[model samples]
Target: LEEETEIASWTENGGLFVGTNAERLAEYKRFAETGKYFGIESHVLSPSEVKEVHPLLRIDDIYGGVYSPGDGTIDPTSVCNAYAKASRKFGGGVYENVGVSGIEVEDYLTAGSAPGRRIKAVLTSCGKRIETPTVVNACGAWANEIAAMVGAQIPLKAMKHAMVLTEPIAGMHSGLPNVRDHDLSVYLKTQGDSMAIGGYEQNPEFWPDVDPGFAFGLFELDYDTFGQNLAGHMQRCPVIEETGIKSTVCGPESFTPDHKPLMGPHPGLRGLFHACGFNSMGLMLGGGVGRELTKWILTGSPEVDLFSFDCARFHPESVASSRWVRDRTHESYAKTYAIVFPHDEALAGRGSRKSALYDELKSRGSKEPLDYDLYGACAESGLAFWLVDQGAYEEGAWRLGEADHPDIPKHQSHEYLDLVEGELTFDWPASHATVAEECRAAREGVAIFDQSYFGKFYLSGPEADEAVQYLCGADIEGKRAGSVTYTPLCNSRGGVEADLTVTKLQDSAGSNYYYFAAGGNTATKDLAWIRKVLEDQNFKAQIEDQSEAMTLISVQGPSSRRLLQSLTHSDMSDESLPFSGAKHLEIAGHPLLVLRLTFVGELGFELHTPAESAVEVYRAVQEAGAKLSQLEGIPVRDAGYRAIDSLSAEKNLRHWHADLSNRDTPLEAGIGFTVLSKLKRTGS
Candidate 1:
């Protein structure tokens, strides 16, 4: 353009203002190096290459490095004028020297369930209150100060930096490309006709303290400490030495504790948005950040995944442990231009893989099915197991041993049993309500829960009851037809063996029955002993093991009563038979034991049916209660069976090994009258 110009002027040195950054060049190098450590498959310029590629002066410490041909520089004063002209042409608001005093924050709260909050406007120093539905705070280093007015902690801080510009040294290809590299932590190259060089190496601690009042005076450089650092860089990079000491400038950088930009809502504050704290990457990532910032102001999060920068995640506690994150962030301000990362997310450091349990659980369902809960467990089942296994035996023994139930294994290697305990100790009214709602669902309609491991027993032929009665030490002579007996089976040595429920059957013959025990494997093991005893006695009873053939599902809800009442043609109510009582009914050619036993304390019935019919029965019950609970809005009480069992035991409803035992005598165990007198007559 100078060749064709009639009037033209050229100056090697130009007025430059990073406005907010003086250049913490060393910090910029670190930030850039970390990215190399964990590299991105993108291109950036290197300092050594910058010296060699441009035919300016003698080069030194030259090595394979980052290069970008499109890099250039400018006079901030001229650029500001250009921007002002563009704004005037576009009719955009331009406020200079006028800073924001107070932001008039108004939240137009439309009452919601919890009232999701938002920000309405930001009033500036010009007494101009920008009225809008959404507000964005792009005040850079002062973001936190402004954000606090809107009820948000911005996780932002201010930093000062310095950059050096060398004297004019004309050479072929007069202006060399702007270059950046991390090897020596410096970016060196051109500034118009002069070598506009900079170093992010200003030792923040060694330099004279900067007065916050004189922030924009970039011409005031850190003369002493920065001079020493600049000398060393010039010694290594010969190009900077050829055109050394043009001028020095300083500016501020905004940062989050994590060294990343903060760009999101002001958390608890409604409609208030943020796009500040770029450290020094603001200009580099500006276009992307700006677009997202606008989107984020409208929506809580930008489409480009900005979760990492949301200030809410930092809170006041998380980053409190490490001061490095804060310090490093400040060091990498405008003057530094440091590589923001250390290792290649690919190569520089460590690597890991998922645990076996997590792999299995994740693959088991469409998504990870086992809910250990991130809020509560904060990890996978394996992680939980690790914590539990650490002091399992010791903690278990301490708490349970004090309660007199030493049956829990001791805190020894072999004795340490793996158990996942999640019940909260404190009371929650909502939890109780959930339990009641579950029970209510069961009673009114059908609710099928996990009873895959429920213990069951099957007995057949003429003398099944004889063997059962002898094994249980209970008299079945008066066990009413179609009735079930709550019997306490015992070991011959006289301790309560297992708590069993035996249902009676006539079947066109004399009375016969089988026992179903309470404890999971305990009942099965006890029944195994009964079969062995029958064989030892040479008894003619036939024992068919039915534990696997059946899975006892309790359809105990109000719906349970209605469905069973319709299925069996029998009415079940508190008046007809008490909670512990039972009845046999025929449903579509299948024989079922309908018992009024509820673990949840709900008014419901349990249908003891074959495992094959479980799905069918479950569907039928679910269908019956579909209109009652699962329909979503029906107001109903629920009783969580698990909670009921725990709470019931606490309330002393039915004892497991206690009331039905010979270990402490029936009276001591709390149930004495259930023992029959006829058993004394049959002493043989």
Candidate 2:
């Protein structure tokens, strides 16, 4: 912009982030850590140093600040003009006062007899057809509508942001440093002799409809809604209240679900690309964004991990509902200057996907699907809890106040740490609802846990046994009907693919059958891997995913048999249904497939039932347990995954994915005893 002369109005003034509260100051420290990670030079300054960095900021309420010395402000209008001039200079067409009416994509028949969708041309509102091999959708706020024309879902939400330019003030020059007071959620910069202040209010206005007519235009002044932010700005810089009224400019900026810009090609369609959803950071990142897009278009990939900004990262539910986008966009905008820690999930727009027993679980204080239900339930009885996200699982467990679990590993990988969603903890509860008490109940009494999310599959056909034997490291032929065995699916290199329990079922007319159960977190990967392996081996076995249809409720501990026996007419003795035995029976008038196995090293049975009957069976088990507790003094309680992990660790059980993964073999995982030498598998 400086050298071109065609758009030389752009001048640079540095930017500063100042904090006025301890929480926000800590946020600056975290930002400093992030800056170091990203190789950005940033310094955390004291209150006195903050004044020296920016004299305009009030340091009385200020705890500290982060100063990005190289950060600067720019005039976006001049930058855009410069970019357009440069594009034209480079022989690129620049269409002004024009809009895209539609995008035309043609499907080409492929060798596999499937059709490939390819962009053919762009239909413009000016009655022009731009025929090109490739098209870039850089429609800014209207990018979503353009993407929708091509049947692509883009989770972009436009929010109305307002800024006011104060009347010219004495001593305020044109080259003052741009300042951001994060605690107040306001920013201030010099506009000639005047000042420009803007805020990202907690509650933001969503502009979901951004048609062509609304393009490059500002919304009318919303003094009523903007007053909250104005108050915050005036409080940060009290001097701003004295300045006379000036121009109030309100415009819309597009935001993605994760607050990062979408600057790559659409994961689905061919010959199409996206560079919109800047989350209001377009002006600062425009040049780099252009370079990134250019590199991606030319070379087919970018260097950095753009998963956070991937346009395809969103699920259909996230983009299909305007309210979801609006709620999340508001969260992103509201926390514009707030520090978000790792694995911090957005609280808005939750539970879009629910299980069959969602209402029953919710009635039991389930705030979320799997992660929060136990904690919320424990809270009802006055329990103190700590939640552990992906990174801090091991450490967070130790940090639990007065933690009583002595078996929690300090050095090795903990399987509970493998949880993608954060794990709930009732450790050191203020009441009797502690994790220690839960473990005790599972060991000395009876404990039940919702294990309905386990990955399940049914394999049948005449070659089912042979097919399973070829893929599993264990001997599948030896597993007789009504029996189960814990085994690992291994690669040719003898590395474990997954640890699961395979149960041999009664053969039907010339076909053998088996039921497989794997860990919940690895459900999708396990299913896909199994299907691929079966396809590669050319097995004639029929496999079906029963994960969503089936539910597994685990009732374990010494009194588990009695609790279950109370609800069933079947024999409960070990002689009748031995350990590792599988039985098809009825509980509370509902059909169920029960497998005797234990992850917690205690006597346990996994009652597998249909989704429709899950709630009834669970309530029956609860009632049976309550009656058992009253008569036999052996109480039955719901146990969280934490207790399960603790008990598993005490029994030296290796957790799938965490303790044993594709890197570990059956022998290396200390489970070679489970692998029989009679039938040789691929890994053997």
Best by TM-score: 2
Q: How many residue pairs clash per model?
A: 70, 0
Prediction 2 TM-score vs. true: 0.62
- Model 2 stretches with alpha carbons more than 4 Å out: 1-14, 78-98, 105-121, 126-136, 151-153, 167-176, 190-194, 244-246, 256-274, 285-303, 311-313, 338-353, 364-610, 620-684
Clashing pairs in 2: none
lDDT, each prediction? 0.48, 0.70
* Model 2, span 129-234: residue lDDT tens: 9897578888777888888899987778877878898998776776666788877788888787888888777666777567668866888878876887788777
- Per-candidate TM vs. native? 0.42, 0.62
Kindly list the per-residue Cα lDDT of model 1 for residues 455-514, writing each as its tens digit: 566555455666666766567765665566666665544445456666665565554655
Candidate 1, position 585, lDDT:
65
